[model samples]
Each structure stands twice: as structure tokens, then as C-alpha cells.
Target: MAPPAPARRPYHHGDLRRAILTAALDVVAADGPGAISLRDLARRAGVSHAAPAHHFKDRAGLLTAIAAEGYSLLADALAEVPAGTPDSLRELGVQYVRFALAHPAHFEVMHRPELLHRDDLEFVAARSLAWHRLRRGVESRAAAGRGPDLEQAVLAAWSLAHGYATLRLSGNIPGEGDPAEAFRALARLTFGEPGD
Candidate 1:
């Protein structure tokens, strides 16, 4: 008879939550959000089948946490651009697309509210922070009379950048040049010269 496999260790209490989230992201990156399950995350993290449930009660909870984290990271990325510079909007667009490219799994989950706890407080706050950052960039341009209509400018900038990022993520935008460069070119064409 063959020997039985060794037992797996319980997840360490200090790192279990992070481990599960990381495992979930890996699974999402590999097979999309629909494939995620608490048991599978626990298995990937080498924890008890119930471990993920302790941190996230269900799949929606887990996805909500991921979306919150994604929005927070996006806010931080946009904050890196100087707030009122002429190039800020262009740079912000590039960063937005870069963030999507860097975190495709999170990006996919972040926009799909039906798969997450969209009413969750943390998720709502994080999403607002990210939206505020993008809106602030557009508002600054409007303040300078570069774009006369604040709401329209915000919509245009956001729609263009988000559309570009989504297209790139879906493998519809092809090129060997850097994605950021492509965004910059498109931004120039759509918004006119960077410092105009």
C-alpha cells in the first residue's frame, strides 16, 4: 500500500488573511473572478477550509475587499501626479491605464459591482477617493478655462481613459510600444496639446 500524504499546517494567524487574499488574486488572475471560492482560497493558502470564511464570510465579501483595495491603490497612483500641472490629466490617464495593466485581476473585479458588496462602507469610501482624485484632475483643468464645462470635461477624460484601459485589458488594443505612450498619444489627440 502507498504511504498517505503528510498533513498540511494550519494557516498562521498573523498572515492568514493576507495569504488568503493573495491566493484569491492569483486565482482571479488565472481563471477570472467566477472561479473564486473560500475553500479554494484556503487550499491555495494551505489553510483549513474554513480559514477564508473567518476573514471574508462569503465570495461577495472577498470580492468587495479586493475592490476596496484596488480603489485605494488607484487613488494612491493618481495622487502621484502633481495636482494642478498642465500634464497632470495626461499623466493621470497613463497611470490609470498602467494600474489596470499592473493589476488586471483586481481591475476586473473592481468594476463589476454585481460580483461584490457594492454597498460595503470600505468599498464605497475607497471608490469615492479614487473618483475624487480623477475628478480633481479634470476640475483643475476646467478651472484654468482649458475645458469650459467641468462635468463634461470630467466625463470625457474619465470615459476616454477608462475606455482605453478596458480595451487594452481585453486584448483589443495591440502594439509593442508602451501602453502609457499609447495613452499619451491618444490623450493629445483627444484633449489637444498637453499644456494648451
Candidate 2:
């Protein structure tokens, strides 16, 4: 009888979990989150087909991880902008647009709740952090005697930034030069000069 084929070795390497996540992000960037498969991620990462499952459990788990990571990144970006001023609020909107453009895969997956475990603790916490970061500017504006309704201010800012980014990402904004500049002009038009 032929000798049994050599047993397949388990994947062992530097940060297999990160590798799988990165590969999945690339697929997400190219073909949207719905196109990703754990098997495909394994192939892209040069591991056995079962290897990705060891880390992510399933597709939803992988997406929840991505969403959580994305929100944390977004919160960090927002935090980098100076706070507690009208100009800072405008800057936050610009930063929001920048993050979406820079991390299209993460941006895409972060908003699609149907594809993730929305109640996952890490995901919820990250999302809440990002929301609070976004809300900070609105609260600051209210504090500065603008007297804007807190909920409305937050929703307006979010809607503006999110809508602009979604339009640009969908190619609906033709020949948009410099997303930051475009956003700044739109913000100025909508809300007047930052300090107004």
C-alpha cells in the first residue's frame, strides 16, 4: 500500500490573524465585503483553507472585527483634530471624509450591520467611541452660544459628512478635486465660515 501522504502542517507564522484580516480587507476593497470568503482569505494569506476559521470563526465574526477596528481608527483620527471650537467642528467633518476615503474597505463594512455582529462588545464599544468623538464637536458648538439642538447638531454634521463621502465613493461626485477642499467649501456654504 502506498505510504500515507504527509500530514498537512498547521499554519504557524507571524500574526496569522492579522494576515487573514489584511487579506480580507483587500478583497473587501476590491469587491465589497459581500465578496469575501474565509477560504479565499486563507488562499490569499497562503495558509490552509481551514486556517482562517481558527481565528475568525466565521464571516460575520471577521466583519465584526473589521468594523470594530475601523471605528477605533476613526475615533483616533477625530481625536487628533483640536477640539472645543467651531473651526474644530469643521475640521472633524473634513477628517471624517478623509477617513472614509482612506479606508474604503473598513468604511464599507462598518456601516453594513447586516453583515456583522452588531452587538459584539468590542464592536459596540468602538462604535460608541467614534460616535462620542463625532458628538464632541456638536457639544462644543452648543457650549459656544450657538444654541443648536444637541441631537440635531450631531445628526446634521454626521449626515453631511457621511452623505458627502458616500457620494464621492459612489463616483457620483464628478471630477471632485481634493476631497478635503470640497468638504471645506461645502461646510462653509452650509454653516458659513467656521467661526461664524
Candidate 3:
């Protein structure tokens, strides 16, 4: 057999944290979250195995960062929904599904709280912001007399969007049309139009 390949030099740079996180996301996208390990991430980043520990500490910590970033991105997407409009709810739901589709790896780690350090300050704050944004969108409709029950409407909208996203990501959705249009049609069908 040929001689063993030499190991890569340990990465030393100003943005190792971002590099490691990007590598982790790539790994998760390619092999699912269960395959992620700090050592593996370090290897992918061409860093010493111990380098990841400096930023993430452990698997949970790394996952938590991914989840936190997902929530932050989700919050930004939902923020585009105009407040106090009945159709804003549907818009928010569409944005939610779109965000999931665009960031499948982040979406996967985000909803699996058990895979992350849920109590991390940044993670908690980001999660709270995303949750509050969703709630506010639902509440806007209720306030405008579009929905009868705030809690029920919130649950229904969330379930509908999340279910669609999950199904789409899992390849359970069937059709030739654009997935975004399919999502919009499903939202209208299930929720009975934006204002209704």
C-alpha cells in the first residue's frame, strides 16, 4: 500500500468559529445531524481536532449555535410580514416554509431542541425572538377581528406551515408546480384564504 496521507495543518485564523460552523452545517447537510462531531468538524475545517473545543466546547454547544443562527435567520424572514394585516399570517407561514427550504440543515437542528443546548443565552434569546415574531403575526390577525381565538389560530398556522415544510423537505409533497406556489395553495386551502 502507499504511504499514509499527511494530516492537514491546523487552521489558525481570525474567524475559526465561523469556519467551523460553516463546516458543521455542510456536514449536517451531507450526512444529517447525527453524524456531526467536533473532531469531524475540525477535520473538515483543516484544523486541529482540539480547535473546535475552543469555540463550541462539545457537540451540544455546536448544535446550539446552529439552532441559534437558524432562529435568528427565521426571525429576519418573518419580520418582513407586515403587521396588523389579516394576510400577514399567511405571508408569515409562507416565509417560514421558505426559510426551512432554503436552510434545511439549520431547520433540522433548530426544531430538535434535545440536540442542542437549549438554555444557552444566545440560543434562548434567538428562539424567543422567533417565537414572539410568530405569535405577533397571529395576534395581529386576531386583533383585526380576522381570527376568533389567538392561541388556536397560532397553533393552526404554525402546524400548517411546519407540517408543509417538514413534508416538503422529506419529499412527501407531490406535484410538478413550484413548491412555493404549492405551499401558498395549501395555505389558502387549509386556512380558507388570508382574511377569511
Candidate 4:
């Protein structure tokens, strides 16, 4: 009879959590979130198949962490520009698109609520922070009667930016040129010149 295969060693050193997350992001970027597998991620991260469970209880847990991280990153990107100005709003949209493209893996998972633990506290807080940043730009417009209702303005801005990013990412935008430039052009068309 043949001998049994040797057992794999457990990952006990370094940041296994970060390593698994990085591997998961790579897989998501290459094949979308549905293609993610804990076994595959562990293999890619050079850990035992059970190692990912130490950090993420399951696939949903892993995705939840990714979504939270994505929102936090988006919040940081949006916060760079000063809020409560027309120019700042435009810049925020540009930043949103940039973040989407720059982190396609995280972007993909972040928007798919069904694939994540939607009630996760970290995810909720991070998402709320991103929304707060995005909403700040519209508050001034609504207060000054320069824009539509506050919620409507926020939704409109979000729709435009998210739609553009989704289209661009899916190759439906029909351009190999600069995406941010295209976004600015579209923004100009939709909202007219900044001072107009």
C-alpha cells in the first residue's frame, strides 16, 4: 500500500491575514468575486487550506472585510478635496471614479451586498463614512438653493459617478483614453460649466 500524503504546515508567521486578503484581491481582479475560493486563496498565499478561517470565518466574512476596506479607502479619497463647493463636488466624482478603477477587486465586492455580511459593523461604519463625505458636497448646494433636494443631489452625483465607473470597467464606455478626463467631460455636459 502507498503511504499517505504529508500534512501541510499551518501558517504561523507574518501577517497571514493580509496575505490572504491580497491573494483574494488578486483573484477577484482576475476573475470577479464569484471566482474566489478559500482553498485557492490559501494556495496562492502559501498557507494551509484552513488558514484563511483564522482571519475570515468564511467567504462572506472575507468579502465583508474587503467591502469595509474599500469604503474606508473611498472615504479617504473623497476627503482629500474640500467639501461644500461646486468644484469640490466635481473633484469628488473624479476621485470616486479613480478609486473604482484603481481598486477594481475591492470595488466589485463593495457594491455586491448579497456576497457580503451586510450587517457587519465595520462595513456599516465605513460605508457611512464614505456616504458622509460624498454628502457634504451636496449639502451646501441644497442650502444655497443651487441644486436639487439634498438627497436627490447626492443620488444623482452617486449615480453619475458609479454608472460611469461601471461602464468604463465593463468596457462599455468605448474609450481607451483617460477615464477621469472622460468623467469630467460627462460631468460638464450634465451639470454645465462649474460657474455656469
Candidate 5:
């Protein structure tokens, strides 16, 4: 009879899977998705070429994992800042940018629909939750008497934040002043806050 399957040896230090993911993220941040390769990631991770494949079946799987993690993280960030009225949506918008800046690797895959597992229940749940939070925040702002049309207000808020994040990530916006502050200004304009 064949021996029983061996138990997983507890890894005391750096886990190979996480190390590969870390290296993969570094690659994505430095060169974007098109430039990332499994062998390169494995080499950078200091693991066998097969190691990454063990964790992620292929490039798509790796990217999907990154997207899932990004969604989960964004959801957490949205949850961190309370869904208050007026400035809450604005604050969440800034936090969204912050999340991308902080996790550029994750950000690289988060919004790429092609790379993500949109049909997967877990991915769908995470994405939906983050969006729901944003929508709820918009509703709260409207409740606080700070809007015109609900759909318009939410769409405007989404566009401002999403566009700002995309621009910042793509280097379309040069460094001079604060990106968040710029985003806040846009949010105010979009929300029609005060005399604009």
C-alpha cells in the first residue's frame, strides 16, 4: 500500500507561495501586466520555476488572485472610514486612491475585468461589497442634503475617484501638489458643493 500523503511541513520563515506573490506584485508594479512572466516571477521569488505554478496554475490564475485580494483590501479600506454624510464619500474617494498607491501591484490587476474572475462568487462578493459601500455612502450624502440626482451624484463621485486613480497610476498627472486634494476638489465640483 502507498504511504499516506505527507503532512505539510510548517514553514518557519518566508512562505514560498507568499514570496512568489510578493515578487509577482513587484513585477506588476514595475512593468505592468504585459511585462510580467511566470519564470521571471519565480526567479525573482528565489523559487523553482514550478513553484509559482503550484500556487497559481497560470498567469490568469495569478492575476485573478491579485484581483481578488485587491477587491478584499479595497472593501476593507472602504469599511475603515465610516459611511458618513457629505465628506464621507469624499474621504472614501481619497482612501481609494490611497489604497492603489499603497498597493500598486494589487491595483494593477484590481480593475482589469479581463484578468479578473468576475463570475466567481468570491470575486463577485468582494467587488459588490465595495461598490455597495460606495453607493450607500452616496445615499448617506444625499440624506444629508448634499446632492441633486441620486444616480447623477453617485456616478459623478465614482467617475471623479476612478478617473483620478487611473490618472495617478498611469503617470498622466505629474507630481506637484497632493493628488487627494485635487481629487477632493473634483469631488466637490461633481457633487456641486457650495458655489462652484
Candidate 6:
């Protein structure tokens, strides 16, 4: 016998890829991207050391996949905020902050520049789609005479949400009372305040 044909693995080891990625996400979430490693991930997933390599060539490949997944998730969150309406785009701003809070692993990978593959096709496509959706919302608000201008509105919303997420992640914004509720309260006050 030819060494029993290497014990042919199962067609699906209870979604091995997903398990590995999930393990990687947990690791990245707790300690950030630099903490991720294939050997550990495989061990956590109870798979062979080479298993993750089959799905992702290396650490960078894993991060790229995580980032792509993050963009897709952000797109879904933005979709929940409605299409039109004055400052409807801001709802997505709120959602973005919330998503980051809920999925720090994905968010970390999505924003980390040196870790992810900039040339990744899926990552680029999903990121473009998310950005276009945000831009369309901003332009619509501007056309409806609610937003100041397209660029300004986009910048305002992006900065506010991104800043808020960073603050939450970095513990720059302290206190209890739920980060999501605090985020919404601050957003309402920020955009709803008087004066142009």
C-alpha cells in the first residue's frame, strides 16, 4: 500500500476554514493583528499545521480575507440605515461605530494597512461598494438641501464615525452606560446641534 493514501481528509471537517478564521478573529480581537499566527490558529481549530496554509497562504493572506469580510459586513450594516432622508447617511455613521465595537477583529483587519493585501480583488471590490453607498447617501442629502455639500458631508460623517470608533477602541472615550448608546447620544448631539 502507498502509505494508506495519506489518510484522505474529510470533505468538510465541520467547516474547517470558518473555524480557523473564527479562531484567528478571536486572537486578533483580543490582542490585535500582530498576535495572529497560523500554528496557533491550527492548534485552536484542532486541524493539521498545514491546514490554514491550504486556505490562506500565510498570515497576510488570513488578514486580507478578514478585511474583505469586514467590508462586506460594513456594507450590510450601512444597508440597514435606509437609502434617502436628510442625514440618513449619519445613521450609517452610527452603524459604522457600532459595527466596530461589535466586530473589533474584522474592523482591526479592515483598517490595518501593512497587514492586509492592498491588491486583493475582493477587498478592493467590497471597500469600493461600501464607499459608494456612503457617497450616494451624502450626495442625496446634499441634493435634498439637507447636507452642506457632497464632499463636506462625506468627510463629516466619515470623520465623526471613524473618530468615535477609534476612541472607543483605544479607550479614549471613557465611562460606562454602553458604548452604543453613548455613541448614538453623541451623534445626535453632534449633528443635531444648532448653527451652520
lDDT of each: 0.89, 0.90, 0.88, 0.89, 0.78, 0.81
- Locate the minimum summed-lDDT window of 10 residues in model 4: 137-146
Scored by lDDT, the top model is 2
lDDT of 6: 0.81
Per-residue lDDT of model 6, residues 81-161, tens digit only = 777765566677778887888888898889887998889899899998888777776777677666586787788878888
- Model 5 over residues 1-196: C-alpha lDDT tens digits? 9999999995443677777777778888878877768898888876677778887788877787778778889889888777664568888888888887788788878778887556776677888888887787788877767676889888877878878888887789985698788888887767666322
Sorted by lDDT, highest first, which candidate order results?
2, 1, 4, 3, 6, 5
Model 3 lDDT, residue 20, Cα: 89
- Can you list the residue pairs that collide in candidate 6? none
lDDT of model number 4: 0.89
Residues 1-196, model 2: lDDT tens digits: 9999999996467899999889889999989998999998888888888888887899999999999999999999999887886687789999999999999999999999999998899999999999999999888888886747899989998999999999999899984589999998998887677667
lDDT of 3 by residue, 137-158 (tens): 7888788777769999889989
Tell how far residue 20 is off in model 1, in angstroms.
Answer: 0.9
Q: Candidate 4, residues 130-152: lDDT per residue as tens digits?
A: 99998887686667666778888
Q: Write model 1 residue lDDT over 75-128, tens digit each, in one string.
A: 999999989888888889988999999999889999899999888999999999
Candidate 2 clash figure, as a count: 0
Per-prediction TM-score = 0.91, 0.91, 0.90, 0.91, 0.82, 0.85
Each prediction's Cα RMSD?
A: 4.4, 3.5, 5.6, 4.8, 5.4, 4.0
RMSD of 2: 3.5
lDDT of 6 at 67: 92
> Model 5, which residues run further than 4 Å from truth?
1-14, 194-196
Shift of residue 163 alpha carbon in model 4, Å = 0.3
Model 2 has an lDDT value of 0.90
